[model samples]
Target: MTETGESGGRKYDPAATHNFPDERLNAILPDLLSDPEITTYLEAQNVNAVTRKGYNDHGTKHVEIVRNRALNLYDLLKGGDVGFNGAIDQDLDEADEPVIIALAATLHDIGHVVHRDEHVYYSIPLAADLLDRLLPEFGFYDASEAVRMKAEVLHAILCHHTEEDPLTTEAGVIRVADALDMERGRSRIPYEKGGRGINTLSSQAIESVSLRPGDGSPVLVEIEMVNAAGVYQVDNLLKAKLDGSGLENHIRIVAVNTKAEDRLVERIEL
Candidate 1:
């Protein structure tokens, strides 16, 4: 499946996956691949059925998903005025920062290739190791800079699951983008090998997502869902995702399509 946004007709395929905006990534991939340990681990990630359902475990799909999703979120944030007011504006263009964000988002789920219980826990270390091993190849001054980048990437990758961690704008953007797609697709894929129905059943397709600024409190985001199934899914899973993505207290489900008639039901916020 291709990920395309309304703004740019750009779609990423595995065919030419390395057209990075920054050249720093070019220097890094070779070193990353040079380490047989990482290669071996990444290679063995496909044996599990659950891993097969995710975007990036064993194939190029995950990377493409990450890149497209990350870019899409950036676009949305900029459109929503969040970029100008948020840290993304400050850090997006810093040398290789976009690549760092894109790469982390792309690689964050590799641990799921092993186990789902704590994918973040495993993926972060792997990312750090890969970055360190590839530092020389990437032409970093020394292992120190590589380690710093690794730390930053790890911060973004690991914290994508929860907001408690130090959130760089790139990380926050990746987390939200990674999550928004759960409703767009992948919900029909079975979560377990022997799962009966759609393992990742979707709650709804969001018709709109809007944010309201507050005086002293946190930002408020209102989400509108497409159907009752969407409602069920949001209440059960997506809400947690919102909270985890650092929008829990800030985001609210304002309306839904209850009749399945594809007509939006509006609720007044009191």
Candidate 2:
């Protein structure tokens, strides 16, 4: 059921295997994705489309994208000795960092099952319950450790909304990764079906996002756009997310207009 392919010239696979630093996370991700509550939440977005208004998918695919990006950012920052707070800096094992980030990213949007507006607040309790049930399966039999992990993951999930600031490295990674999901496909359905205006137009202009280790920084985020409009997604949305993320200083972001010989429109560094 897993296959690798290119998306906007970048390699991606919906079923890609991520080697989590934590063996517990690696063993549990597949089961978590298949959990009835999680699957139903994702499906509810599309099934109740008429009630929700035209919106980009807030489903499993979106979770996968954010999960991958969050994990990649976490690994890059941790390897560079970027200081992280919350559970990462506390008594938790180093391997637990990726677990926290991945769980936060994966479950961040499930709150949409309640409603989209201010769903971040709703995600907290839902995510906490899921974590409580799932962590024990990952061998987190210690009550204190389970509570710490749930608290950290919920913080990251809560901070993903623009109104909240990420207080930890893992939360920052989740915030930025959530913003990075602004590629065209994300907005295509809404855009095609009368979802007019700046949000849709700007999102459609984005062609791809490529993340890699930077030559001069800990991480590089390269955004490719077909038109100047994509600037809104990068400058307004992504920038806001990164501004509050703790990783700002360790990361550099560049947005290029591919249709214009790769002209750089925005370059930001902390």
Candidate 3:
């Protein structure tokens, strides 16, 4: 999918709703995926995290999931007729919204390349440098507009973790999307190698997470779990990210445990 998007404009994979529906995203996707610098940082982050620290997946896979969900959340909000324009304050066009989201989500954790302890801080400078190089490829915006977009994207990356209050709707979207990557396959590499840590346990409990338009809100996040333990991923982790995400009023979250328990955790005691 990334290969196709990189090669032929932004031809997204024909998965459920995975395509870049926004025209702005369609323009930016090809440049983003094809950037060797961006790809290097994405891969390097995982080396420090998954290899050295034994953390869950934090490379291309994790970023891809976050980028997809962030844009999907953006779509849901826009589809619900919410008029809050993330680009308005900066005097940019609304078409700039998805560009901010896609860049922020893709590079938010690249700071992990420096160290996982404060990867968010590390990501800002790295992302800024890459943005300076890549923004020219978008073409629709002027140099001044590109500068403002860079600031917005950096803000979203800065606020994606640690419960920082996100000032823009785009930043909030990135925060929530980061937390949404807590499903099973995300931690599979670590768990399969005999990791029984809490991160692995919680992710393993989550059978699936589906996001869609909500009945009452703009977005609905439905989490299906095989064991009650998955609640920790939501209650402690997702809740923390969502607390200051600025999407509190726009999104709904629901988690349910299936009656069918997988043998991985059929019987357990804390």
Residue 141 in candidate 1, Cα distance off native in Å: 5.6
Evaluated against the true structure, the overall lDDT of model 2 is: 0.76
For 1-270, candidate 1 gives per-residue lDDT tens digits of 143553122242334333234355445544544557654655565445345444213333444445565654444343344422122333333445655665676567677666766777878767766666554555643655555666667777887776444356667756655554434333323433343343243422445444333433234335555654455444554454555554343334454453457554434231
Better of 1 and 3 by lDDT: 3
Which residue segments of model 3 deviate by more than 4 Å? 1-21, 261-270
Return the TM-score for candidate 3, rounded to 2 decimals. Answer: 0.88
Clash pairs of candidate 2? none
How well does each candidate superpose onto the true structure, as a TM-score?
A: 0.61, 0.87, 0.88
| lDDT by residue (tens digit), candidate 2, 4-101 | 22343222233444443556566666787778877777677554332366777777677777887777776667656787777756688766877888
Model 1: how far is 81 from its true place, Å? Answer: 6.5
Count of backbone collisions in candidate 2:
0
For all candidates in order, the CA lDDT equals 0.50, 0.76, 0.80
lDDT of 1 at 238: 49
